[model samples]
Target: MERLKQITSLASLAVFRELYNSQTDIYAIISRFLNEIISTNGKYNFTLTEITNLLNDSFGFTIPEAVVSTSLGRLDHITKERDIFSVDKEFERTSNDVSSLKDMSLQKSSDIVDGLINYIEKKKTYV
Candidate 1:
């Protein structure tokens, strides 16, 4: 679609800047979402299904498996960590890397939606 192409053409910096300039309350919401994922040491371990359920509950969106897959791929590209995993027969992110998990969760928060969009846009550039 035209929108997808437009999104694809955007640079990562542009994407991040757009996200950073978004409303403050958005960031707060995102931060809260990220905080929820934080374990005792500020980390989380989630399988793809778990993430999908969490996102559905938090954002009220039905994120398709392909979409989640693409998002995970983009996140992996930017973070340069194998946060996405394949377990038994499902995809997952089970690392105890607290900071990374926080970042990913934050990125998925409504407040940081723009940032995540930017991250994905930028990730496309690198690929």
Candidate 2:
């Protein structure tokens, strides 16, 4: 569509400035949806693809998936982490890291993992 061409052609900063100067409907809608998600689910549950589609249709912007993933964190309303993960899979991963023991202190296990990962990065111990 013509709108898609416009959105994709313009640099994001220019688009943002134009959007900000002209209208904030996109931001308002996104913020409202994020608030609703938090009030009902307690955290961001929408995937990047979902948000991308929403923005493309509602705001008429050809938003990139990476931008949506990062933009949520930029907004104070949405809590964003580095990446998305399956909750069940994450639990299994953490449990496995903790020697397959469910009784271990979760905090302690997390700390250990954090420390090991940080140490590796700090020392540049890469394969």
Candidate 3:
């Protein structure tokens, strides 16, 4: 019984460690993706095909176009303060936010805090 408990505890610790590492990696990837999108803002329009190619070239992630589109949608949600899509009959991508990222510097600590807060709030709302 003692040996079993020890093994179980060790396994749990290992699993936790792996989970932590994976989360860190994911956060890093997301940050990199954000940076890439910020850098190449003017190159593409609202089309996901263009965005996917740009992202794949920049990050070497080769993420599916659908995933890139979804992330862009989430970015839109987070930065809703910026009117990215005009209310016109045809949806057009506004250039406001793209120019802003170029001018504004990102504060990593604040972003991490805000990201965590957003994640928690999303979880609360959904779950």
Model 1, C-alpha of 18: deviation from truth (Å): 7.6
Candidate 3 lands at a TM-score of 0.35
Q: Write candidate 2's Cα lDDT for 1-127 as tens digits.
A: 6633433333333434444565566654343333332333433355667656655554345667765555555555444445441122222111121121211333344555569779999889665
Quick one: best TM-score, which candidate? 3
Candidate 2 residue pairs in backbone clash = none
Give Cα distance to truth, residue 10, candidate 3, Å.
32
lDDT of each: 0.43, 0.44, 0.46
Model 2 residue 61 distance off true place after TM-score fit, in angstroms? 1.2
lDDT of 3 by residue, 3-115 (tens): 33343334333433444566665444443354446545643234556656765554334578656545665543223224332122232444433233322322333454568
Q: Compared with the true structure, what per-residue lDDT tens digits does model 1 show for residues 30-118?
A: 33333333322223455556665664444334556555545544432122125543322232433333334334444445345567779
Residue 27 C-alpha lDDT in model 1: 36
lDDT (Cα, 0-100) at 47 in candidate 3: 54
Off by over 4 Å in 2: 1-44, 81-127
Candidate 1 vs candidate 3, TM-score winner: 3
**Local lDDT at 81 for model 1:** 27
